[model samples]
Target: MATAGGGNAHMVFRRYLDAVGLQGLASAEAAGLHTSEWYALSLITLEGSLSSGELASRTGLTTGATTRLIDRLERAGYARRAADPHDRRRVI
Candidate 1:
């Protein structure tokens, strides 16, 4: 049996999830992008800029998936990849 506080916490968590899902859906639709793309864009915006590895870790996506996501964003004009200034071998 769950306590009232536990039930309330569950409700709050559910509502938060719903709100976040709706916002992500709406934003993706507005941008003519997939939800994952929008999510990646949001992460990039929050982080300013991140390398593919960093993005993968942050988003829980594999490196290959992150590469594809970045490719999509770049093709859609939502993102760009640039060489890291300090590290010639890295991209950001």
Candidate 2:
């Protein structure tokens, strides 16, 4: 019989797979979205509008990589960064 920890681990793995499967379906439905775009979208949905730096942190992306993701999102009309309300030096 599986121990409680083993059972929990199995459930966790199943949950992860389920989430991945859903993401895959969503990505396929999106005309131009691949895994990276999906990842960025998921982060934006969960975290709301963020500066490029903040978006990078939430998505586990480097600044350059995040910029690429933002470009994709912008092209796809999924995201945009507004100028920071308090700081004119940045977009959020």
Candidate 3:
């Protein structure tokens, strides 16, 4: 059904999501990152940094997969992990 504004919510949301995805793809190409990696990078940049577990949760990936993603990103020199100052067990 269409919303009061004459737009179908689902269609509108899908368009907005698609536009964002396209923009991400373009940005990823420019930055030499995979599209999924770019999305992760965007989240990291938006929040300065986050723990691997947090990143995994946000990206809807397994922690192991997220670790692999981080490894790739690190090797590409796009990101690095550091021990959190207040907590040595955590990577930031």
Candidate 4:
């Protein structure tokens, strides 16, 4: 996307993001995962563990949607809920 003299920086960056998003979708599809599931899994993997509310906040999903997402992942054998240990009321 760069031209002879460092050209089209904005367009180049936009295109790069678009390509990456498409690739993520394709890879998730190949793995039989929804795009949101794939992204949440990536976040969880990176963090090791986090609470359900945190997942909802980070993913910009409503609490209900996040819960449903977790349910799906659990059914698929990809995720599980665990107690926070520090907070009995919290699910991680």
Which candidate leads the pack in lDDT? 4
- Where in model 4 is the C-alpha error above 4 Å? 1-7
- Per-model TM-score versus the true fold: 0.83, 0.71, 0.79, 0.85
Q: What ranking of all candidate models by lDDT puts the best one first?
A: 4, 1, 3, 2
Lowest lDDT 10-residue stretch of candidate 1: 1-10
Query: Candidate 3: which pairs clash?
Result: none
Which one wins by TM-score: 1 or 4? Answer: 4
Task: Give me candidate 4's TM-score against the actual structure.
Answer: 0.85
Q: Put down candidate 2 lDDT per residue, 1-92, tens digits, no spaces.
A: 55566587789898999998997877746656877778778777887778889888877889999998899888889888788888999897
Poorly placed runs, candidate 3 (over 4 Å): 1-16
- The alpha-carbon deviation from the true structure for residue 33 of candidate 4, after best TM-score superposition, in angstroms, is 1.2
List where candidate 1 sits over 4 angstroms from the true fold: 1-5
Which sequence of candidate numbers ranks them by TM-score, best first? 4, 1, 3, 2
Higher TM-score: candidate 3 or 4?
A: 4
Clashes of each: 0, 0, 0, 0
lDDT of each: 0.91, 0.82, 0.89, 0.92
Assess the local accuracy of residue 38 in candidate 1 as a C-alpha lDDT between 0 and 100.
89
Expressed as tens digits, the lDDT of each residue in 1-92 for candidate 4 is 34566458866987999999999999899989999999999999999888888999999999999999999999999999999899889889
> What TM-score does candidate 2 reach?
0.71
RMSD of 4: 3.5
